[model samples]
Target: MAKAYRKDEFEFFQNQVGKIDQRVKSYLEVAGFEKWTWVYAPVNRGRMMTSNLAECINGKLKQARELLIIEFLEEVSASSTHIYSIYDEGKKYIVCLDRSPFSCGRFQLDEITCERAITVLKNKHVVDMKPYCSEYYYPEILRKTYDQSMFPMPYKKEWIVPQEVIDEVVLPPKYKRQPGRPKKNRHKK
Candidate 1:
């Protein structure tokens, strides 16, 4: 395989999907089941197709992408705290599930998704992981949590300015500067 083609992610995925299909066929035939049918459609009739071999391949790809290979060591460098956290709690966070912990009831889950990463990176095989990798899917709450954590400043949702602020603050800014204190007007009797 040429390096150029390897650099194109979709091309890489297509190739990977092919390779896995072949492996599954071989493994099944070798086990004396020349033909066996399993579920390819993802759960809930969504596009989230699943096949054991296919999932394995996708997972490997994600782990490789996570490697963050850099031109220099510093290129891959991140805060020590984060790196340590991944070294420590990441394993559990990535622990394998009977089925992918992240797969959901929605239409988006696929054979290759980040939620299923433990299956690929857990074993540290990237080629095997490719099919399973997409930015790990998150539950809505987790997605919100992740958004909050990653954003240094939370996005301030657009809102109606308080009427008090608009009427009192911004609208009253045309104060004319008086040269001296206001002179008391003398009433002529």
Candidate 2:
């Protein structure tokens, strides 16, 4: 039902639900078909519906996560030691169409844009930029992010305040309290 983008396909799934299990039809009647429609949800949770991917990653990093943060970082760095720029080895980039890094788990960050950029760069016989990428796999953006200083709270004597900005008075919002006893938890309707 979630993958059903068309009306007919959606209806077909709805009808099929009743055929599979009578109890499911009753549940659907109570919950509504919109509940099963992923497209209607606020967030687009792509195709995956299980924790199999996480389990696979956890299986790979089973020993690493058990180590200390510094050790973990070292393990990660050691694991990707083989990943390097072609220039490092005194070699030029190869623009082979068959050398796509699809399903490499690196393209999931900025799906369409990154994939398109990679493909375009590969076609143009540019450098292999797969390695040396961090934090969303965009080095320029990552560098720019680290370049800025996170300003911490300064001493009161060092603080500078505009008189007009501080002088302006603001009133707290006014509200009337409800008469009924408040419910503890908000139950979904």
Best by TM-score: 2
Tens-place lDDT digits, model 1, residues 53-155: 3353345344455554563234323221111112333332322232343322111334344433443355554454433434444355447665754535545
lDDT of 2 by residue, 1-189 (tens): 765533455668878988999898788668865567643443434322222333434444679988999999887676543222233134333211222222322232222223443655665666966442324547676688799789889998888999997899998899889999987997889
* Residue 173 lDDT in candidate 2: 94
If scored against the real structure, what TM-score would every candidate get? 0.17, 0.28
Q: Which stretches of candidate 2 lie above 4 Å from their native place?
A: 1-137, 186-189
Clashing pairs in 2: none
Question: Residue-pair clashes per candidate, as listed?
Answer: 18, 0
Cα error of candidate 2 at position 78, Å: 44
lDDT (C-alpha, whole model) for all candidates: 0.39, 0.51
Model 1 earns a TM-score of: 0.17
